[model samples]
Structures are given as C-alpha cells and as structure tokens.
Target chain A: MELFIDITLLTFLCITALAITVIRKLFCAVMLAGIFSLLSACLFVSMDAVDVAFTEAAVGTGIATVLMLAALNLSHSREKCPPYQPLLALLVVCTTGAVLVYGTMDLPAFGDATAPIHHHVAPRYIEQSQQEIGPPNFVTSILASYRGYDTLAETVVIFTAGLSVVALLGIRDRRGGQSITTDRSAMKGYLVLRVVTKLLLPFIFLFALYVQFHGDYGPGGGFQAGVIFASGVIIHSLTLGRDRTLKAFPQRFLTILATAGVLLYGGTGLAAMVRGGNFLDYSVLGATALAGQHLGIFLVELGVGVTVFASMTLMYYAFSYRKEA
Target chain B: MDSIPMNVSGHFNYWVAIFLMMTGFYVVISRGNLIKKLIGLNLFSTSVFILYISLGKIHGATAPIASETFHLYSNPLPHVLILTAIVVGVATTAVGLALTARIYEQYGTIEEDEIRIKDESL
Candidate 1:
C-alpha cells in the first residue's frame, strides 16, 4: 500500500517540476515551485524522514515562495526565446541524461541494509555513538565530532557568500534613506504584522536554542536552527520593509557579527593549539583529556552555529540592499 | 543505457526524479529568464532531497521515534539532514526571489539576454 502511494507522489512531483520548467510565465513557474516543495516534503514524510518533512513544509514551501514572489514583483515574468536553433541543446541534454542513467545501474538497492554504507561505518556510528558521545541522536555526533571539518567548511561557505555579495554591491548607499518610493502611510498594513512578528520573535529564538543545544538529545541541530532563526529576521524584513529591519540589525553590525563568529571559530582552534594538540583536536581544551575534548567540541559547535546563522542572513540582507546603490 | 524499464520495476521513482532534475538543469542553463532559472534550481534541489530520503528508507521499518516496545525504525539522520537542507533551500529561494524583484525594478525585465543588452547599452 505504501509502495503504491510512493509511486503516485513521485509521479506527481516529477510532473510538477517539468510543468514549472515548460511554463513560459515566470510567476506561474514560481508558484509551481512552491507546489513542488510541498510535494517533495510529502515525499520525505513517506520515506519516514518526519523532521526533514517538517522543515521542508515550513521553509522550502513557505518562505522560499514568499521570497520568490517579492523578486517576481520587480521584474517581467516572461522569457525571450528564439523560434529555432534549440535542436543542438536538446541533443546535448539527452546525451548527458543517457550517461547518468547508465551510471545508476550499479548503485546499491534503495536503502539496502546489505549495502557497505549501511554495514560499514553507519551501523557503528548508530550503535556505538552513545558510548562514544553522550548524544542520543547520531546526527549530532556525526556533525559535531566525527565529520566536524565538513561543518566548519560549510560555515566558511556561508561567510564567503556574504562577502561576495558585499563585493558585488559594495557598502555605500547612493541616496541614503530618503529615496524609497513608498512612504510611512503605505506601512499601515505592516502594523499588525509587526506586532505578530515581535510576539513570534522570542519563540523563534527559543526554538533555535532548543535546536542548537538539544541536538544531542533530538534531531534538531545548529545549521537548521540558524536558518530558522535567520528566517525570523527575514520575515520581519519582508513585512516591515528593509529599512525598518535594518534598524533591528544594522548593516554595520552584521560585519561585526560575521567577524565575531569567525573569531570564535579561530579561538577554539587556538585553544586546542595552546593545549599542545593538532587543530580541532578537542582533547586539548583541558588537562583531563576526555573532559577537554568535550568542552572543546561544544565550544566549536557553538561558534559554528553563530557564524553560519549570522553570515547566511548577512548575505541575504546584502543582496536585498544591493539596489540602493 | 538499456533504453528500457525492463530491468527495474520498483526503482521507478529514482528515474523520474533524475529526469525532472535534468530537465530543470536544462532550463536553468538554456532558458534566458531569471525566474525560470530559479524554478530550475528548485527542481534540482528537490531531486537531491528525493535522493536523500530514498536512502533513509527501511522496508517494513517504522518511523524513527523510539517506542516503548523497541520496534525497528528508519534511520532518522537523513531526515535531520534534509530538514537543514530544506531550510537552506527556502532561505536561498527567498534571497533569490528578492533579487529577481529588484532586478525587475532596475532593468524592467527578468530576461537574462535583456539584462545583458541593457547593461551593454548603458
């Protein structure tokens, strides 16, 4: 019965994706993209990834659609295409698709327990993770301790993206604050929304805290929580306008946030270095080896969380503010 | 490579996901519209999500929640990863949307070719 359901949902998702692509109208395509996210989230639920399904439903289908709409409001939604000369492109795409399809034949059975990935490191991580780390959720251990380097690199990626936006658009506002087309009277609708956002802000932040620290006990973690917290700010910016949101988190302060996060990350490494261990060697944080490792990992994860959250939001803001110049 | 579905029956979902992903990629690369590119990017991201979820499946297994009786559950790690990926996806989409809107205001059209032309003319 579940198999039948999976097949149906999968079929619908594919169709929706293709429909979005073929549709000449851009707004329609963006709306269809939201539908696609919802469908994909449902597919995740079917696969028993409930946490993922939840995040997808909220973020992918919800916030992404809003952002896309805001962008669409500023531009034409139609494409300029030639009447012909598309045959060569079609041939190229087909060739690439054929090669990839051929490559999938040798892949392990979908979710096969016999697969080496399941048999080798995964089962060990799942079973022994508790003894190795106090974390009940294996995901937390993998992210914070085992594959710590990847998480760190991911943090750097977010920071770099923000810097790139700053480079592309620069920091100077051409007209300063007086040039916006809309005035204070236009913001009457935002009054109610602002109050609601204020109410939700604390809870959103609390949820982020729960996700970050409680990750060892549950499925939530730093990266996901950072984005959610960032969304709260994003939501405020959307309703209250970029100008008002800037007051809450000034553009100048974002650089400080970014720098602080990087420093925290580097500080952890410095702590490890002082303890006479290799970079990211958590055992060097204190005299007692196990205790030090624990302390070091926690500190590093916290730093990582801050950096990822701040930098990602900083980039988004820069992108939005690029027009001012 | 076989050009036939005769070899695999149950794995059909993967094939469809792949097709959608490739088609989306084609749109992203070939189409000159900004919104179309975002649509294509979303498609590509969804395909990857499907790939992750598919990996976490356990035939005849229950949800990953711990039960009193200790029944089997699907691996919840991929689900957690997907959760983070989904949020990032949404945030990215939001940023992309905001950019497109501003692009329209400045350039009046979302077409990549048009934007290039406008920039060149300026």
Candidate 2:
C-alpha cells in the first residue's frame, strides 16, 4: 500500500516538473511549483517525517510562493525562448545523472531494518533521546541538543542570506529622485481582504509562538515558527501596504532582532563555557542534567526563531521596497 | 519476463527519484529564464528529499514519535536533516530571486543568453 502511494505521488511529481518546464508563462509556472511543493510535502508525510513535511509545507509552499510572486511582479511574466538548444548542458546533465544512478545502486533497499544508517548513531538518538534530552520527539532533540552546532550554523546561514538580500537590492537612502513607496492604493478597494487578513493575523502569530515553544514535543521548531510569523507579516504587507507594515515592524527593530537572536544562541554556548563545561554543553546549565538540557534548548530555540522571523521580514521588506521603487 | 534487474525492481523508488532528479537537472540547464532555473533547482532538491526519506522508512513502523507500547519507529535522522535542507532551499531561492530582480534592473532582461549578449557589447 505504501509503495502504491509512493509511486502515485512520484508520478504526480514528475508531471508537475514536466509542466513547469513546458510552461512559458511565469505565473503558471510559479503556481505549478507550489503544487509540486505540496506533493512533495505529502510524500514527506507518508514517509513519517511529519516535522520535515511541516517545514516543507510552510516554507516551500507558503513563503517561497509569496517571494516568487513578489519577484514576478517586478519582472516580465513570460519566459523568453532560448536562442538554441543546450546540447552541451544536456550532455553534462545526462552524464551526471548516470553517475548518480550508478552510485545509488549500492545503497540499501528502501527500508531495510539492518541498514547501516539505522544501526549508526541514529539508533542511539532514538533510544536515548527521551532520557537524555527530555523530548519524546527524537528529531527535535537531535536537532536542538545533539546537533546544536549544526542548527546554529543553519540559523547563521539564514541570517547571512537575509543580509545579502538587503545588501543587494535594499532601497537605501534615496541618492537622487528614486521613490521607495509602493502605491498604497493597490489594496485600497479590497475591503474583504483587509478584514479577513486582520482577523487572521493575530491567530497566525499565536500559532508561531506555539510552534516555537512546543518544538520539543511536536513537529515544529524555531525554523517553522519564524517562517509562519514572517508569512503573517507578509500577508499584512500585501493587504495593508508596505508603509503600515513597516510602522509595525520597523527596519531597525528587525535588524536588532536578527542580530540578537544569533547572539542569544551563541551566548548560551558562551555561558556554558564560562561554567567550565564544553561549548553548547547544556548539562551544566540547570541543577540537573535534563533540566539544563531543557533550559538550553528552549533558549537556543528562541534564538533560532527570532533570527528567522526578523530575517524573513527583512528580506521581504528588501524585496518589496525595491519592487516599489 | 523475469529478466528485470533485482536492483531495479527492489529499489524502484530510487530509480524514480533519479528520473525526477534528471528531469530537474535538464530543466535547470536547458532553460534560459532565471526563475525557471530556480524552479528546476527546487525540483532537484525535492527529489533528493524523497531519496533520503525513503532510505529511513521501515516496512511496518510508524513515525518516530516515541511510545512505550511500540518498538518500531522510522529513523528520525533523515527527517532532521531534511527539515534543515528545506529551510535552506527556501533561503537560497529567495536570495536567487532577489539577484534576478537586480539583474532585471541593470540589464533590462532576465534571460541568461541576453545578459551575456549585453555584457559582451560592453
């Protein structure tokens, strides 16, 4: 039954890819890409990776679609025909594909119990995470506690990416006569949009907080929460225009939040160091080892959430600000 | 009729993943539009996500949620890794789209070949 479902989903995925490639209209392509993401999220769910599916659904389908739509508004909606067929690119791709397929031949079958991956440190995480990290959700404990440094680096990567976007296209202080305000009247007549969005915004924010604080027990974490928070802000910007949104979340505040979040994560590690324990070693945090892990994970998760939310809002501001100008 | 390769039949999901991956690669390389290329890149990464998730599945197990009554749970490691990958993919996509917007501003077109043509004349 699972095999059947997997095959069906993969088939849909293939069709979506083909459609995306054949479609000349960028708008249609973007929508198709959203479908593609949704399908992949379903596949993730069926594979019992609900945490991954949740992230995919939020980031891939929600924020990415919005960002791409914003980008589409800035540029032409139609893709141009290529001057000539890319024979060399085709050859390269085919060779690379062949090599990758050949490599997968030696990999363990889809779900063999005795697979090397199942035997490795993965078993330790599954077996001991409950006792050690105090989270029934092994994925979260592994991500937040066992692999703290990797998650920290991932947060920093997001911070850096957001920073690069701002540097690249951010509307700096007008050197000449370039205007930064988008037409506020763009959403002027949509009474329904404004009302509905207003009703939903607070709930979205509340959910983001839930996802942030509930990471240890559920299928959510800082990364998912931050993206959800940003989506709410993005929706408001869409309905209420950029100026009002900026008033609510000013550039300076967001910059500070982004920086402080990363600092908080690193600071937790430093605090542990000052206590004469290894860096990011949460065992020395509270009176008991489990208590320390809980406190440390909570703090770092907060850090990750804050940085992601601020960075996302900043990136959206950067994109839309330039689009308007 | 029984001549089908064992690896091909047993690891059919892997083959499908490879096919999806190759299609994405072809689109990325063959397309001239920056946005299209980004879409293709997404497809490619998603196939990889499937590949990894499939690797961690057990025949009769449920999600990795812990329970005292059940002994079988799917491997949680891939889920952790892929969650991070999904976020990273979106971040890169946003950055790439931002760059495309800037390119449009400077060169007045988003086609790779056109950008090259414009650059060569300068």
Candidate 3:
C-alpha cells in the first residue's frame, strides 16, 4: 500500500515538474510550484519524516508561494521564450542524469533496514536519545543537543539572507519618504476575507506557540513554528495592508529581533561555557544534566523561532515595499 | 543479468529522484527569465531533499519519535539535516528573488539575453 502511494505521488510530482518547465505564464508556474511542494510534503509524511514534512509544508508551500507571488506582482508574470533552442543545456542535463542514475545503482533498496545510514551513528540517536536528551522526538534531540553548532550556523545563514534582502530592497523609511497609509478603501470590499483572517490570526499564533513548545514531544520545532508564525503575519499583511502590519511590527523592530535571535542562541552557548561546560554543552547547565538540556534546547529553539519569524517577515516587507519604478 | 528486474524494481525511488533532479537542472539552464530560473533552482534543491529523505526510510518503521508501542523508527539523522536544508533552501530562494527584483528594477527586464544586450549597449 505504501509503495502504491509512493509511486502515485512520484508520478504526480514528475508531471508537475514537467508542466512547470513547459508553462509560459509565470503565474501558473508559481502555482504549480506550490502544488509540487505540497506533494513533496505528503511524500515526506509517507517516508516517516514527519518533522521534515511539516517544515516543507509550511515553508515550501506557504511562505515560498507568497514570496514568489509578491515578486511576480512587482515584475512580469509571463516568461519570454528563449531565442534559441536549449540543445546544449538539454545535453548537459541528460549526461548528468545518466551519471546520477549510474551512481544510484550501488545504493541499497528503499526501506532496507540494514542500509549503511541506519547503522553508522543513526542507531545511537534512535536508541539513546530518549534517555540522553529527554525528547521523544529524536530529530529535536539530535538537532538541538547533539548537533547544536550546525543549527546555530543555519540560524546565522537565515539572518544573513534577511540582511541581503534588506540591503537589496530598502524597507521604506517612514520618516523620510511618503508615509505608507493603510488604504482602508481598497480593503473595504474584502470584508469577508478581512473578518475571517482577523478571527483566525489569534488561533494561528496559538498554534505556532504550540508547535514551538511541543516540538520535543512531536514532529515540530523552531523552524516550522517560526514559518507558521510568519505565515500568519503575512496573511495579516495581505488582508489588512502592509502599513497596518508595519505599525504592529516595525522594520527596525524586526531587524533587531532577527539579530537578537542569533544573540540569544550564542548567549545560551556562552552561559553554558561560563558554567564550565564546553560551548553548547547543555549537560552542565542546570542542577541536573537533564534539566539543563531541556533548558538549553528551549532557549535555543526560542532563538531560532524568533530569528526565523523576524527574518521571514522582514523579507516579505522588503519585497512588497514598492519603489518608484 | 538475472537480477536486472530486481535491481530496477528495488531502486525505483532513486530513479524518480534522478529524473526530478535532471528536470530541474534542465529548467535552470534552459530558461531565460530570472524568476523561472529561480523556480528551477528551487525544484532542484527540493529534489535533493527527496533523495536524502528516501535514503533514510525504513520499512514498517514509524517516525523517529520515541513511542512505547513501536520499536522501529526511520533514521532521524536525515530528517534533521533536511529540516535545516529546507529552511536554508527558502533563505537562498529569498536572496535569489531579491537579486532578481533588483535586476528587474535596474535593467527593466528580467530576461537574461535582454539584460546582456542592455549591458552591451551601455
């Protein structure tokens, strides 16, 4: 049954990719990309990577679609056909695909228990994480405790991306330029969407909090939660207008929040170091090793959540803020 | 020679992944539009994520959450790596789109050939 489902989904994914390649209208291509992400998320669920599936669904399908649409709105929606046939590109792609296929011939069959990946190091995480890290979700334990440094670097990467977007598209300085006004008249006709979104905003926030805190027990963590929170803010901005949303979360505030998230993560490591533990070694953090691990993971996850939420919102602001063209 | 059918059937997932990877690669190199190129890059990265996740699957194993009722779990390592990768993927995409937006603003067209022509004229 799982194989059947997997085959079906992969077939659909192939069709979507092919369609996106052929589609001339960039709007339709963007929509197809959303469908592609959604299908991949479903595939992740079937493959037993629930946490990955959740993150892909929220980040890939939700935020990415919005960002692409905003970019499309700013620019052109139709793709100009290339002047020449892409024969050389097609030849390169075919050669690469053949090489990759040859490389995969040596790989173990799908779902084989004795595959090399399941043996080296993975077994330790699977069998010992519950006792060592106290998180039922092994992905969280491994992500937050076992490999804390990588997660920290990933957070910095996100922060850097946010900075790049801000640098490229300056967030309209309210003081110097024409102050952005909430066009209430423009949104008056969206009465149903406005009211529904207003009602759903609180619950969305509550769910994001739930995902953040409950990450240890289930298939969620800071990345997914932060994306979820940002999606809520994006929806609000879309419905209520960017100016109103900016009033609630100013550009400066978001920039600081993005920086502060990285600081908080690093600070947690520093605190651990001061306690005579190695940097990011949370075992030496609190009264007991387990307690300290929980506290450390909580703090760092909070940091990730804050940075991702801020960065995503900041990028949205940067993209949506149109200048005189 | 006798194992040819077995090999093909067993590694079906990997074949699909390679196909998707090539599809994205083709789009990235062939397309002239900057936005389309970015979309192709996204498809490429997402296919790589699929490849990694497929390698981590274990037959009959549940998700890598500790449960008293289930003893078998898929490898959690790939999930951790890919979770971070997905976020990173979006970050890179955002950066690429930002650059594309800037290009559109400055050059007035996102078509690669047109931008090059404008650059030459300047």
Candidate 4:
C-alpha cells in the first residue's frame, strides 16, 4: 500500500516538472509552482521531516505563489522569447542532468542506516545533543551549537543580502513617488483578512520567540525562528494594504534590523574571544562548559534569527517596491 | 508526529524536486518575458521546498503536534523549518506581485524584449 502511494506521488512530481518545462503560459506555470510546493510538502511528510514540510507548504506554495503572481503582474502572460530552440535547451538540460546524476551515483543511499553521514559526525550529534545541550532534536543542537559557525555564516549572508537589496534597489527615496496599481476593488477579500492578520501577527511573533528559545531543547533555532518572524510581518502585508505593511515595518527600521543582526552576531564572536575561548568557541561563556555553550548559542541564535528576518523582508520589499518607479 | 508516512521505495521525491528546480532555473535564464521569469522562479522555489520537505517523513509518524497518546510523531524540526520557509515564500510572492504592478506601469508592455529595446533607445 505504502509503496504504491510513494510511486504515485513520485510520478505526480515528475509529471509536474515535465509539464512546467512545456507550459508556455506564465500564469499556469505559477499555479503549477503552488502545486509543486504542495506535492513537495507531501513528499516531506513521507520522508520524516515534518518541520521542513510545513515550511515548504507555507513558503513554497503560499508565499512563493503570491510572489510569482506579483511578478507575473509585472509582465505579459505569454513569453516574448522566440519559440524554444529545442536543440540548444535540450543539450544544456541533458548535459546538466547527466552530470548531476553521475554525481549522485557516488553518494550513499538516501537515509541508509549505515551511511557514513550517520556513522561519523551525525551520530555524535544525535546522541550527544541530548546529553550536552539537553535537546531532543539533534538537528537543532547541531545547527545552533555544534555547527554554530555555519549558522552564523548563513545569518551573515542574509544580512548581506538585505544590504544588497537596499543598495541595489532602495537607493532612491521613492516614497513620494509611490503610485497605486491596486484599487480597493482589486483587493476585495482583505477587510476581514486584515483583522485576522492583526490578531495573528502577535501570535506569530510569540511563536518565533518560542522556537528560538526552545531550539536548544527541541526542533528549530535561529534561522527557522527568523523566517517565522518575518512571516508575521508578511501576513500583515497580505491582510493590510502594501502601504500599511510598509508603514508598520518601515524601510529604515528594516535596515537597522539587518545591521543590528550582523553586529549582534559579530559581537557574540568577539565576546567569546574575550571570554578566553577561540572565536565562536562558546566554551568560555560562563562557569561550566555546558553553561557557556548554552548561553553563547542562545545569544547567537537570537542574532541569527533577527538578521535572517530582516534580510528576507528587505529582499521582498525591494523587489515589490522597485517596479513602482 | 509519527503519523506522517514514509515509503519503502527509493528517494524518488528529491530527484523530482531537483529536476523541477533545474528546469525552472533554465526558464528563468532563457525566457524574455518578465512574467515567464516569475513563473520559472516559482518552479525553482517550489522544487527546493519539495527537496526540504521530503527530508522529514518518518517510517510511521503522526503530525508534529504534541499529543498525549501519540508515540510515533514525525519530527517537529522539519515542519518548523518549513513553516519559516512558507513565510519567506509568502513575502517573496507579495514582493513579486508589487513589482509586477510596477513593471506594467513603467514599460506599458511587460515583454522583456520590448522593455530592453525601449531602454536601449533611451
């Protein structure tokens, strides 16, 4: 029974991919993207990472669809490109696919129990996180503590992305030039949705906090929490008008958030150095080694979350607002 | 929660996701229309989301919600991460929509070829 379902869903996913390539209509392609996300989430549910699945469903299907639609609204539905040069595209696709497949052949079987990934470093994380960090979710511990530097780098990347968006697109002070393409009529179902979003935003922020704090004990940490935090603001944008969303999370404040996040991260590393540990070592945060690791990780996670949220928000804002001018 | 089902077959989902992602990326690079590019972007993103979510399913797990009687709950971690990803997607969509509206205004025609020609003539 289970194998049948897997094969069927797998087939559907493949079909969607093939169909997306052939589909000429932009709108259909965007809608298919939503379908793709939904299917991916279902696949995740089949895999065992419920957390990743939930995010896929939300970000992939919901927000990405909205973004694509917005982008579509920027242009015509039909592609203006000359008809597909089948031979060229096919060659490119085939070469790329062939190379990736060849790479996969050398990889261990997905989720194989005896895979080197599970044997070497992953096992230490799986077993030790419970004992050292007191977290049931080993992935979180690894992300937040064991591989803290990587997470830090990822956070910095987001912050840098935010800065890039600001530099590239937000250079002009176009608030005065902002024009309205959407009438009240085009945004019909928003009155009630706005109220609902207003209600939910606080809870969303709260949930972000919980995820950030609880990351040491369970699933999630800075990156996930940061995304959720940004999402709360996004929901506000969707419900209320774009203008209102802008007012709530003004561009200046977003820049500050991004800067603060990077500073916080860098500051944490500096603090660790001062505490007599190597950069980001986290072993000298306080008294016991465990205590230092825990405290250091927490502070860094907060920094990471804040930075990611700001960056993601800034990117969205830059893209959305630029077409206005 | 452990209610989420896993399969005995191979990791087919990831492959599909990767394929869609690559195709979408190709479209984005090759297409001239702005909207078509957006569509391709969606394809690319959705494929990655698929890849991420496909990592979470347990052999026999329920949803991630905490329940008293549930012994085999799927790992809540992936779901949490996915939730964040979802929010990012929403934000990206909102921005994309806004940009589209602006593009329509700036260029009158949304075709990339026309926009580029207009730009070059300027």
Which candidate leads in lDDT? 3
lDDT of 1 by residue, B20-103 (tens): 778877887778777777778878887877876787787776556544565556765666556556555554554565566667
Docking class of 1: acceptable
Residue B76 displacement in candidate 1 (angstroms): 6.7
The TM-score of predicted model 1 comes to 0.82
Regions of model 2 farther than 4 Å from truth: A172-186, B1-9
On DockQ, the leading prediction is: 3
Candidate 3, residues B69-95, lDDT tens digits: the string is: 999999999999999999988988999
Error of 1 at A55 (Å): 4.9
Tell me the RMSD of model 2 versus the true structure: 2.7
DockQ of 1: 0.43
Q: What DockQ results for candidate 2?
A: 0.72
lDDT of 3 by residue, A1-325 (tens): 9988998999999999999999999999999999999999999999999999999988976689999998898888899987658899999999999999998878998898989999999999988887888889999999999999999999999999999998988887553453555354226677899899999999999999999999999989999999999999998888887667877898999999999999999999999999999999998898999999999999999999999999999999888785432
Give residue B39's error in model 4 in angstroms: 4.8
Model 3 DockQ reads 0.86
Question: In order, what lDDT does every prediction score?
Answer: 0.67, 0.86, 0.91, 0.64
User: 1 or 2: which has the higher lDDT?
Assistant: 2
Residues A120-154 of candidate 4: C-alpha lDDT, one tens digit per residue: 55445544655676456655565566666766765
Between candidates 1 and 4, the one scoring higher on DockQ is 1
Across A1-325, the per-residue lDDT of candidate 1 in tens digits comes to 8877888888888788778767887778877887888887778778777667756655664346655664554456566773336667677778888887777676655655564545566666666655665466666666666666665665666666566555644555333555444524125576787788778878988887887777566656666566677777777676667766666777678778877776777777777778788777666677666576567666766776676667656766655565454
Span of ten consecutive residues with least summed lDDT in model 1 chain A: A179-188
Q: Which tens-of-lDDT digit does each residue in A1-325 have in candidate 2?
A: 9867977898898888888878989999999999999998898888889999999888975689988988988887899986667788779878987898888778887777888989988889988898998988888899888999999999999999889989888854232442335445248789898899999999999999999999888889989999999999999888887666776888889999999999999999999999878999998999999999999999999999999999888888887888556
lDDT value, residue A152 of candidate 4: 70
Error of 2 at A220 (Å): 0.4
Q: Report residue A77 deviation for candidate 4 (angstroms).
A: 4.1
